[model samples]
Every structure is written in structure tokens, then in C-alpha cells.
Target: MPEFIPLISRQTIQNRVREIGKQISRDYQGKDLILTGILKGAFMFMADLTRQIDMDHDIDFIGASSYEGTHSTGQIVFTKQPDLEYRNRDILLVEDIVDTGNTLTKIMEFIQLLNPNSVAVCTLIDKHERRKKAIPVKYACFSLEKGFIVGYGLDYDEKYRNKPEIYDLKL
Candidate 1:
């Protein structure tokens, strides 16, 4: 097994998720909130976050893939999208991590084409230094250092996602 070093504890993640949810509820009070979760990564975070959000919000999933064994292929091939029409709706895109910003930019651009009232981004982890585009992260739980992270919905080779806490995959 590859060595794993503890990063964020499970308790810490739960606390942060609740905080982000509260903030979102406050900011989007009385609005039609639609959360678009980027799939295969943000599924866990999306579930926890949406539960904490004390509003009647709709949830949807958008599947976009760009990783090939820990390296982004620099191309986002969208495989799935939401069925609901996003016109004039407050759309929040939830992501597991924001790294190169390429995938998120492409996803946001695609959503923008739907004529949504507004679009915002919320990420569980922000790899700020790796960003290549000026994508705004309206809400972020943690800012990760330069390293390969796994667990707590993040994975390496599709493993470690079941772990309840975040860890650094020590190579």
C-alpha cells in the first residue's frame, strides 16, 4: 500500500462543511438555489453540504472528466449534464478541488450559455497556486499545499475515497 499522511481530520471537514452551508444559505436566502455538483469527485461533499443548507435547494450533477492518473489531460470532455433548465436561476457549481481551473472554466462557460441568473463556484479544496485561469472561488473550505491529496471524496487511482479523513498520498 502507498503511504498516507493525515491532512484534514474528519471532524475538521464536518465543521467546515457546516460553515460553508450556513454561509450559502445566508447569501442565497429566498432565491431559487440550484447546486450543480461536478461528479465523480464532489459527490460526497455535495451530499453533506446540501444537507446542511437549510433551504429548499435543488441538486444536480454534471460529470466532466480531465484527469489521467493524477495529471490533467488539459481537455474537459463533458459526459453528463443536469436535466433542469438553468435559465435565470442562481446556480452554484460545487467542486472537490480547484487545481488548474481548466475544467471549472469549461463547465462554467457551458452553464453560462444556459442564461442563468448568476453563477458561482464553491470548492472543498483550493489548490490556488496551480490555477492557470482567473476562476473565482466564491467559497472554499480548505487551501491545500502542493501535494497529492486523497480521502474525504478525493481519490488516487479511484482508491482512498472511502476514507473519512483527508490525507496526503505519500509517493
Candidate 2:
């Protein structure tokens, strides 16, 4: 087990998510929007963000795997392929966190083949220092410079994801 330190509270996360949702609502108003969440981690965030957004939009999930334990293997494998027709639709990839960004980059490469009208990213936690690729993260709720995080749908070996608040996980 990892040592857990309280980081972002549940209330704080909700408030920020609400703010992002409002901005997204304004930005994509009168446009075809699809909220495609990167699964497992982003599931909780996607559900909460969906309620916060005051607009009609579609919800979907995509899965890509890169991490084995705490470290990323640098190779992305799609666990779940995108099922929606993205052609001419604005697709927003929602995430729980962005680390090296290799996963999103690979996912984007695949989605581009679908010929979506526009594509963007939204994340609950943004780790800019670890970014290895240029990701279009349009809406980010929180930014963390370092540390492995857990809770609020983030996990370590698939544990601690049920916690409502975010925590710094020290191995």
C-alpha cells in the first residue's frame, strides 16, 4: 500500500469541474459535441462533468493502456476502441490526468482517421511537467507539478479509485 496525503478536496474538485463545464457549454453551444472519456480513470470525472454542463451532448468512453504499475511502458494499447461516428462531430476527450500524454497522442492519431470536425481534450488533473507530447487540453481543472495521485477515479494497480477526494500517493 502507498502512503496517502490529502491533496485536493472533493468540494474543490467539484467547483473546478463545474467551472470547466460552464465554459464548455458556452464554447460548444449550438454545435454537435461528444464527450468521449478515457475510461477507468476519467469515469468519475465524466459523470460529474456531464451533470455540470448545461447542454445536450453525447457521452462515450474510450480506453487506452500505457502504464504498468506506477510507470508507463511508453507503449500504448487500445483496450477499448471508439464506437461513435466522429465524422463532422466535435469530440472532446475527457481524462482524469495527463502525464506523458503518449496515450492521448496515440488515441488522437486513431480518431483523426475518423475525420472528426474538431477534437480537443479536457482533464481533471494536468501534469504539465511530465507532458511529452503536445496535447490539446482545452479545459483543465487542476494542475500538479509532480507526485503520483490516487482517488477520484485515479488508481494504483486499480485501488483507491473510489475515494471522493484526490490524494498524493507516496510509494
Candidate 3:
């Protein structure tokens, strides 16, 4: 086990999420918006964010996994699917973080097959430098350095997911 220091505090994360929610609410006002939460990791952020999105929108969840322990598994497993028709609808994909871009790439590709009118991504944090694939993020709260982060839904070996603050591993 390694010691870790808090990176984004709980209050800071809440404030940032409010800001992001305001932006999304403004952008999709009066439009049919479908929120797709990338499950497990994004669950906390998605729940809080949706409460601030003042719009008539539907919510769905998808569970995808590309990591095990502290490493990328290099494969994506979609354990759950979003049960909604995406055709001609604006879709927002909510994610906890975008790291390496492999998982996001596969997710975007899979969503595109549904023929949505538009598809955009919103992430709580982004590791821009670690992106291996060219995946564009439409909305992001912050760009983080390359580090092992946990908390606010991110986890290490399935621990720390419930931590209110975000912390970086000392190693």
C-alpha cells in the first residue's frame, strides 16, 4: 500500500460539477438530451451532475471496464447497456476520467453505431498527456497530470471509491 495526498477536495469537486452542470444545462436547453453514464466510476459524478441539469432528459447507464488493479487491461468489457433509442437525439456521455483514451474510444465508437443526432463527452478529470487515441472531450472539469488517482468514484484495487476527495498515489 502507498500513502496518498488529496488532489481535488470534495468541496472543489462539487463546485466544479455545478459549473459543468450549468454549462450542460445551458447547451441542451429545450432539447431532447439523453445522459449516458459510464458506470461504476462515473456513478457518483453522474448522480450529482444530473440533479443540476435543469432539463427534460432521460438517464441511462452503461458499465464498461478496461482496467484491473493499477493497469489498463487493454480490452473493454461492456457489462451493461443503455436502454434507450439514441437516433436523432443529443447524447451526453458522462465519465469519471479520461485516461489513455482507449476505453473512451471504444465507448464512443459503440455509441455512434446507435446513430445519435449528436454525441459529446463530459469528464470529471482528464489525463490529456496519456491519451493514446484521438478522443475529443467536449466538457471537462480539469486536466490532470499523469498519476494514479483515486476517490470521488475512482478506485484503486476497488478501494477508495467512496473517498470524498481525490488523491494521488505516492508511488
For model 1, the stretches where C-alpha displacement exceeds 4 angstroms are: none
Candidate 3, which segments miss by more than 4 Å at Cα?
none
Flag the better candidate by TM-score, 2 or 3: 2
13-107: candidate 2 lDDT, tens digit per residue = 98999999999999999999999999889999999999999999999889988998888899998889787889999999999999999998998
Residues 41-141, model 1: lDDT tens digits: 89999999999999998999999989987888998999898888899899999999999999999999999999999999999999866778888999999
Residue 169 accuracy (lDDT) in model 3: 74
TM-score, predicted candidate 2 vs. hidden true structure: 0.97
Supply candidate 3's per-residue lDDT for 41.
Answer: 93
lDDT of each: 0.92, 0.92, 0.90
Candidate 2 stretches greater than 4 Å from native: none
- Local accuracy of candidate 3 as per-residue lDDT tens digits, 118-161: 99999989886678997789999888878889988998878888
Q: What's the true lDDT of residue 103 in model 2?
A: 90
Better of 2 and 3 by lDDT: 2
